[model samples]
Target: MFQYFRDSNNSKNQVSEFILMGFPGIHSWQHWLSLPLALFYLLAISANILILIIIKQEATLHQPMYYFLGILAVVDMGLTTTIIPKILSVLWFRAKTISLPECFAQMYAIHCFLTMESGIFVCMGIDRYVAVCHPLRYSSIITESFVIKATVFMTLRNSLSTMAVPVLAAQRHYCSQNQVQHFLCSNPAVTRLSCDDRKINNIYELVLAWTITGGDLGLIILSYALILHSVLKLNSAEAASKALSTCSSHLILILFFYSVVVVLSITHSASKTIPLIPVLVNVLHSVIPPALNPIVYALKNKELRQSLYKVLKMNIKKT
Candidate 1:
């Protein structure tokens, strides 16, 4: 069934779109299932957008670390935005189909934001490294120019990284098997239906997945290693305690964020029979972090707490 239906080749037809069987078995309480997801979606996006606004308007958040935090917040929101709305539609609206190009765009956007987020986290770690390891030179070193360069490089790198995926995917043919396992279109899902030899595409996906995603994750880990080393060398107990506290917050976030993605990847790879309540599992990776991030930052970082409270006061006044 996976053959191109050119005029010359009438016997074979390509699959132009995919059917997403998102959460099939939740027949009993679809409304109950969808309601909480909608609420979480709204809460996550709103919280992240709020943090972005406060970071932009509040001049005190202009440091290299906070600059990366603000960008990461935006990326987090974008990532959730890409995934959650589609899930909501399937759960709440009973819409489950995505056109071929829409699928590719959604996949690409999710990967882009994922790449951007990984880079930003590593960048923030570097900021901490410099701040702690080279305290005397930190001021002169982490200029706005440096931050811009890092961010721009990350953008270009991530955008360039996945350019081959859709192009390669287009070369293959599908014989109209519209059923997809999950809610949204994913790389392996789209490629699996192709008539052409997907060895190259599969290889490319591995390269991008491991090299880009895994490689970026590696850098983040290394950055933290160095930061930890530097933190440990502190002579004073109070100084070490403070450094450890800062490290703890970041470690909590990193573990949660990456753990979700890794688990999702593993589940997606393994599950031949995509269960019902599938949208809910996807929600774990998308909505939870954005919803939890502001809370983490507010509770852990003094600066964000003060800024958050001030922003609340400003909103109260405006109302």
Candidate 2:
């Protein structure tokens, strides 16, 4: 809905900078927080990279689930990379400014990764459902060609989807306000900074959530429902138990991921009225979940657990 307000000369409307309001903490505590945040970022990157390496080298992991996990790792890397380093700079060096292009890049990267992660989760859910429901056909159902095509579709859709945000934002004149309440350029945050008509940006923001986040969540839930239904049909307790275990971890992850996004959406929309709470929720959305996701998945999955150890051993040996 937003269009870029270009000067009549069609030259760049030069907006030099943006202000970031980082978390509220004591000065000493902010530095301390940087230590932990940096550690978490390192861990996230290392763990996700480890997962990717293991999946690539281990023939056993050349399956649909691990393939989706690989995709998740990539998305995790992109999302964390987009937001965390800038946050670290603010916390560590007291630099809390971003240029307009950098702001747009961050927004695009964050939303692109987010959309991919959501779509990847849905694909993962579908894999699990098929594996549990029609084990006999699981192989054929999620084949190499199928995976390739699905990956292509998701990559294209995700890459193209968030573009609307910047496009919409481009329509608005940004001379009046330039302070972002939080770290990084999120759609709503940047939209708020625009001085021109924000209706288009706002509309696209809502539409993006519904179509990308909401749509992905809907598919995930539907996949899980089918999986649960199929699991119920298994006559053997062992079969049912195995199926339940396979899905339980996914269910937990799906719940957490979807919850964060939905809460962020609602909280942000409400921030116009209830300010502090929404900001807190946004921080939770950006930080806690990314830090926790790999940890939880690695902890719960036997393969990932073993792969992590293998990764650690390799690193130690190299060092």
Candidate 3:
């Protein structure tokens, strides 16, 4: 479609930078978006950082669960940082130019952290599974060493898998139209601008999503299935209720995560009919989880709540 605008010089096929179109048909009020986006950025960053600090300062939070939570906070921060800063720049200052390498880097980081989040969710599901289904071996199964290994493996696996997305995107010959319609450098959005075919990119993305996110979803479902079985066999209604309650927060988080994802995917496909929904969903998907994760844990987990209270008290005393 962009063939006429294709780079004529064979020697310089790649564009140096791309203009990120923050939002379509709303440039007049784009500045108004800065307030909420900035607020989300602040909340996500501060909440994640606070979670990390409290986990570090309180030795009581040195368990495997907290370790995983700390890692989740780190990933959430990375995920938010990947897009929000650039988004704020676009909305606040109309500075929308992003270098090719920088765009690719953002794409890579977003996918990597997203995949890492999925991996962490799977790990958390497994942690819950062990705690409920195999109480005697919970400690042995999710030790400090195991956490380290799990973190390393998750990082490595996702890094290796997600690297291809940016690599493939960078390889594409982007011609005259260098304006990206979306806020972030998403794979499909970037690929759509290319003069060349993106069949491989599309297929690879589908396979990757199904393999990583889809597989994680499957494992989570299976884990909960076994958990339900164990809970049901408890014989006592109170015990069953308690066991189900323990999974509630994780379930809520998972539901929000996947629900947004599914809705975004659907909206993207039908975007011509409903143009603004996908953009809003895309922005929310990146921001809401990070802002909510710490709050969820703080509200739902007794240990984290007490530690947060202690941290707050200490800060209050300093004043």
What tens-digit string does per-residue lDDT give for candidate 2 at 152-253? 999999888888776666555667566777766777777787666688778877888898888888888888888878888889989889888887667777
lDDT of 1 by residue, 172-252 (tens): 667657687666666776777776788998788878879887887798788788877887888898997887677666677
**TM-score for predicted model 3 compared with the true structure:** 0.94
Model 1 lDDT-worst window of ten: 1-10
* RMSD of each candidate relative to the true structure: 3.8, 3.2, 3.8
Q: Per-candidate TM vs. native?
A: 0.89, 0.89, 0.94
- For all candidates in order, the CA lDDT equals 0.75, 0.75, 0.86
lDDT-best of 1 and 3: 3
The parts of candidate 3 lying over 4 Å away from their true place are 1-14
Candidate 2 residue 203 Cα shift, in angstroms, is 0.9
Q: Name the best candidate (by TM-score).
A: 3
- Whole-model alpha-carbon lDDT for candidate 2: 0.75
Model 1 gets an lDDT of: 0.75
Error of 2 at 304 (Å): 3.2
